[model samples]
Target: MLTATKMFMIVFTLLSIIKSVTLSACDEQEILDISDGELLPNGDVVFDGVVYENRDYFINNVTGIKTACPKLVINKCCPFGTGYKTRQCVNITDSFDAPVWDRYKLIEGARAREMFRFRIGKINCTRPYARVLVSQIGQLDWSDNWHLKSDGKLFVELDSSIPPWTVQPPDKYCIDTFVYEDQDGKTHTRLDALACFLDETPPNHFEVRSTCMLLSCAFILITVAVYAWLPELRNMHGRVLMAYLLCLFVGFILMASMQIMLTIDNITPHICVVLTIVIYFALESAFFWLNVMSFDIWWTFSGKGGMTSKKMSKRFCAYSLYAFGVPTILTIILTSLEFSGLPPHPLLPMVRYQGCFLFGRSKLLYLYGPMFFLCLANIVFFIMTALRIARIKHETEMLKSKESAMHDQHRKDKQRLLLYLKLFTVMGINWILEVISALYPDADYIWCFTDVYNVLIGVTIFIIFVCKRKIFRLIKKRIKENFTNSKNNSEELKYKRTIPTRLCEDSQHQRGSVETIRTTIGMENGVTAEANTTIL
Candidate 1:
């Protein structure tokens, strides 16, 4: 398991790097056109001879029109850059001059049309005039500048003028452009440069979907790391957590890759996403089984094994079936339905752009279905454990007063049992908090608080279990030493009293023995004297 976890971590890291690189590339490529110049069709002119002092000029040549008339009032507004301005024609010129004006007309059946026109006149021209006209008939209409239209339509007009003559469009000519004044009170025109009109195409939905999937995957990795590294999380709990995280990781990867593939017009993205969701559901169901295992430990220790065992056995078998069998069956059904023009959801129909997983309503199944069942299972386990603890506590207290050896043993047993109960009770509370947080993703603060709770519980248990024996030994040694010292003191006091008294008694008895011997001898002498006197 450790090896597998390490390998998974390595893989996750590599995938993260790849995802970051891919995202950066995508961001860089997001803007379609980067050139500063306005993009136009084939017939657009770039004039170098026209001298403009401070005014700006923008011409639309596709419509065979010019607006350089003195009465043709033009105002310029800048939209994007400082160099150019958006210009609009307020009036039309009365006189028409061809020498000072350059016109590019749209040809019939022409594939490309010029986008801009400029006026250039000689010094000694006979009819020195400037007239810009808007033609109605053309294959391409530069007059319909799509960039300037409020409703995303194509419309164009002449705007700013320079020294001799500068084409200037009015400020209100286009809704998209704006004008700004400098510190010197000099006004500058800004024009919204026309983006290259390729085709009206939507972005690849798969790419966006894939990016979202990558985010989800990153979250899963974080979950995995927490489960693996946190000592508070037990083996069984870690396993369950890892399983769920892995399921999510796989699902997100498939979802993301599917989106990318779909964006690139690949056919396998849909199949992958469906398969992933099914697998995720299976794993989620298995997580419930793992929860059952944890609850079973509590149940057995709490002496509520009979019913809990039965229920857990059935649940274990059911979970196995769901974890392996259900996903396989679902995959087959969904795959068949996908190809049969009878998909489960319209958003996932035929695996088209509209039918992708990101756009699919079937996502609700993946998001909420497994979560509902898991939450229910967690609640059931928590309630069972709590009830068992309550029952055991009641039983312990009931038998505490029994005046028998058996009852004494029972009391000790109950103490140990109660200790275990307290430990598991803490665990149960943590698990409950975790389940609640999982159900409510927005409650991250609650989840973090639960982490601290779990850590404290774990530290408390470690101090109890790991350091308890040493502590008890130290206490026992201290008690034994104290007892021994007390016993020695008592013995010394007893010996002190008895030894002097015993020596005094022994001396008195010896004195008595000596007196008795002396008395006997004296009597013998007296008798001898009496015998002698009688003999005389």
Candidate 2:
């Protein structure tokens, strides 16, 4: 009995020794050493991870525990506490012993509660113009918002969608995606709004401008539809109007889309570049088309009814190329300068690094300069057109005693001339305002007027060209035909109803009396002084 008891004691002692050695080996593999690490420009570090070379024990992003922590720690040794682990948001320049990095930095006290989760702590960087990021478990998560705290206050939300967010030397702001509750939500005192305003700058004016551009887009679309829907209205005048509206339609669309896209988080530079080029081409084409209209009108009024239909067609084709081609070439040159960064002129204030900005004096020199010349040239054309109409009027007055076909044709020409004038005035005035405003950047009142005018360009066009008697007549004519067709269908349905189910069964058999049935159906469908009785 004594020998058996001694053997049992010896085996239990051996088991205890094996268990202690196994746990010690696991502990040796879990922790990593952070000494002699090098810092990167973007808040990343390069370390051998020699302290806990075995990755099974160290988790990334510091979000949670590894598979070995809970099963082996005996007393929940993860995070090691106080003297064990040091984790915080630190600046590259900050020393390991910096008190600010630890004071403002976060420690997840709640991490002790959840065995599988680490309470992510937040930190405030002290470095000026530093490249910062929101890392998820030591990995870059660009989508995460950098909730910056300045003196423990909420700063302006910086976007990760843009290129690296950095404040200019004089200004201070962080690029962050979301607003943090812990930080009071206030836009940083020195936020340079222009940094994030690449697609549409002057953030305060964005809503007003976008509203106007979107409305203009809607109006231009309607005008284009009017020209397309009625083939009969595809005459020379109508075709020119359609072309003008189409250009305006495209330009307004780009303006509206850009305004909204600038607010988005992740917009590419190439997309902005394309939008800028297209908008320039479209607006230029619109301006030239306006010039073409004025010239066409002058030609018509100046002729003694010598403008033949074939000649009109030829002129339209030639003018279209002139109008579209000029803008195309100008756009190509401007685009090359923009893409290659070889511009001869100084870049716009906000456009130095911002993609696709065009609201500067330099862009006006290349792009808007041609438009200004077109506007000036068209003004002379308008004057010539007016003089021709006056001469025609004088001739009509001299022949006032006689009403000849020539006089009637002159009267029609006068009406057309006036229509073109109204169209020109409506379209040209807004552009004029734009130019004047550009010249006098300090002119607040002029800009306000221009803002309202540019948006209402489409409405003005609709009233001048689309609300006319001829266009209205076409609309009413289509509506009338549709009404008649629908009325006939309803009458047939009524007749069918009147003919009982028994008669409907014999409808095929009544083919011999088709005419009589038609007359009966019409009588039943038509309303009169008294209700008509149909005998079928």
Candidate 3:
């Protein structure tokens, strides 16, 4: 009663059953039994679970198969231990229903089983067989920095000592490889299982940082605006301060936006690299402008005749060139090195490889290196200026000259220098913390402090400059002068209007009298001698 299809199905089932039975037998005893120490036809010997390279390379003769052999034969055994070998060459016959991970298909499946076993309270540290070799990715190698914490979580500490590229988060998942060993203490080279690192940061980390940065940027803009609006703050020193604050504002805003974009995954690698370059340029320019301020202060006290140089405009131009030009050159060098196709090194500014912003060695070398020199130079300038100031003070006191305009000008310069010093100290401390955070990224307390400090930078500058009693007095005077001038202008305008009206009336009356006189003269001429006598 069976049709052709029915007969074919029955035949296929019988063949599959036979194949399964044969494979099961192979699984139980993979090698054919022979005399001890006997070599196979291919000149290889199977000893225990491992196949020796040659007849002489047996269990007794083998010293360290883990390191001595390059290629390893994977065996079906417990998952965890010291010497678990890769299953890259093993055929998948188990019905564990594992997902595929390219070359790690079998390894991933085994890892799933291991994880399941662990979650089900199957982890036993007491027994050698109880330990499981669990890793998610086979391609990744283990590092000494990777450690198992007491809470059973894998923790990796990435410091400046390690190359950043090595610790870069993988696109798919994280990995941790483990070596497995048998009860006899022989280490087996196991295929490393791959799992992803929990790359999730604190939930509000980016949001809070970006918020603080933006708040600082707003204060910076306010500071710049205040300086620009008040003429008293529009002098040479004020101009330099404004320039520095503007550059800092630009850097902060762009950096905050970049972080926000990164947090939302809205930015691409190309954009990230571009933004980083721009941010670097802005921050560098800001630092250079700060240096310019320091040098200018030093020059003022250094008895440099050029402090009142014939062309103050030319002096500003020179400062602009130094501040802007150097950053441009540095940026060009950074861009060139990035595209030069050089092999990845610790010093190379691998902006694109980092996904967003510079970090680790690249940041330390590129961002911090020049800044370090600039800061050092600034410190030197400050010291020299301080010495010059002390000398000037002593000379003035020795001269016994009354408070002249020159003395007052010197006093103002000293005050400006103090302001610059304060600014330098603030920024110097801020960047020092930044460097420390970059070196030890795991230090959460440092990061928190830096975030709070970032918010204070602009506010502190504003307080130092615009909130002074002298500045307030100048603002009040400027406002009062403006008001008084407007009042005078209104009164003068009314008086001029009254004078014009009165003069017009007087001129009209005079014209009428002249017309009357002309009429009388004409009548006199007509009447002649006879009419003149009658009128008299």
Candidate 4:
């Protein structure tokens, strides 16, 4: 009785009901398994209602474009003056974001979750090439240092010091890197996740830098030895030179340690904070003393109210205090600012980075500012000193035939003036150039030469002070004394032995002779015989 359309609709409805029932009964045992909510492959435990495996909330949540960074919640306070691991590998705009360069991608998404929760400024560098490993929530299994694999994927090796934790943070994170083809001029560096461990073998250039500093350290030691061995070189100039060398020695040593041992993760924490001060003291002392030296030479050449060497010698204590005290005050101010926990007034962003190395930004002003000015002063003084020397040269030439003594005196003055110029070149000018290189870090071309010069300045100092004829004379004198000392002692021994034997022979002849010889040997050596006569 119904139309054809009505008959077709009834048949279709019955078939749909049968298909729905069949699909619903497919997984009868596990429809809503409420015993455990869900088991995430990444080991995250979720108790909320949504059953079965769901990738949206865990894996895909973090794996998506970084535009959806999790809300930042400050759960802990980071202290200053300590070295910390580089947990926050940042890219742009004041947060740890992946670099947007190089159409590159991070390989493992799971370990990236662990990297994000890493705390800053928290490791001690007990060994070289060490790594700071992090663990899961429920177990003590650790994630070792990350490295670039042969195929360009960053592989974070997993090490288990204890049984693996059943639950862990949502794993899998990555940074997209942008690299450039070297053949083309458009260059770009893809700074990916910084390796958390100090490389056992640093890059080739780092080795050269290390070698340069080491060589300089050795040369500075030679200079120190020369100064210590030769008392004559302990004049005002020599003393200042020694102070500068000492500062560089320590500074370079710290620098070398940083180059060899530290990374973002394996920080040289609490101890490095104090050593940082020592490093500052070394640099500041060197700079302050170099300025004092330049001023002294300039005044000597000016000849108006200029103190003689004897007079300048009296100011050594005052100069020492000025050189050391000023730096101490600045260091104290910086330390207070660092721990204040307020907006970093001038500590620089490096304070937030690895501990103790770039501890503060104020160093640029408090440290480098004075250094720049001092270098400037030294340059002016060097010119003034040189001109004064030229005038003396002309005057001496005019009076050479007439006044032989004055001519010889002026010649000696000229030599001393020349030495000052060499010192200025080595200590003042070279350091100024090095500072300039630091200011413009992008200028790699200039850095190469300046780096070498700064590192080798100790060698220059040794050549100027220790390798000179005066130092040579003192060294030769010491050597001659060492060889002659034994001979002189042997001669004295021979004289004593022969004289004693001769006296003994004479003493046998008479009691008077024995008494006289006993008296010559002294009462301490005289022996009384039974015959009531002294025996020698």
Query: Which predicted model would earn the best TM-score?
Result: 3
Estimate candidate 2's RMSD in Å.
25.0
Q: Count the backbone clashes (under 3 Å) in each candidate.
A: 36, 8, 29, 16
> What TM-score, computed on C-alpha atoms, does each candidate reach?
0.30, 0.53, 0.64, 0.54
TM-score of 1: 0.30
Per-residue accuracy of model 2 over 155-180 as CA lDDT, tens digit each: 22244333223222112222212212
Residue 247 of model 2 has an lDDT of 90
- The candidate maximizing lDDT is 3
Q: What is candidate 1's lDDT per residue for 302-339, written digit by digit as tens? A: 65434454665575556456555655665565456556
Give a tens-digit lDDT track for model 3, residues 224-305: 9878878877878888899999999999999899879867767777787889899999999999999999899998887767
Q: lDDT per model, in order?
A: 0.43, 0.57, 0.66, 0.54
The CA lDDT at 192 in model 3 is 36
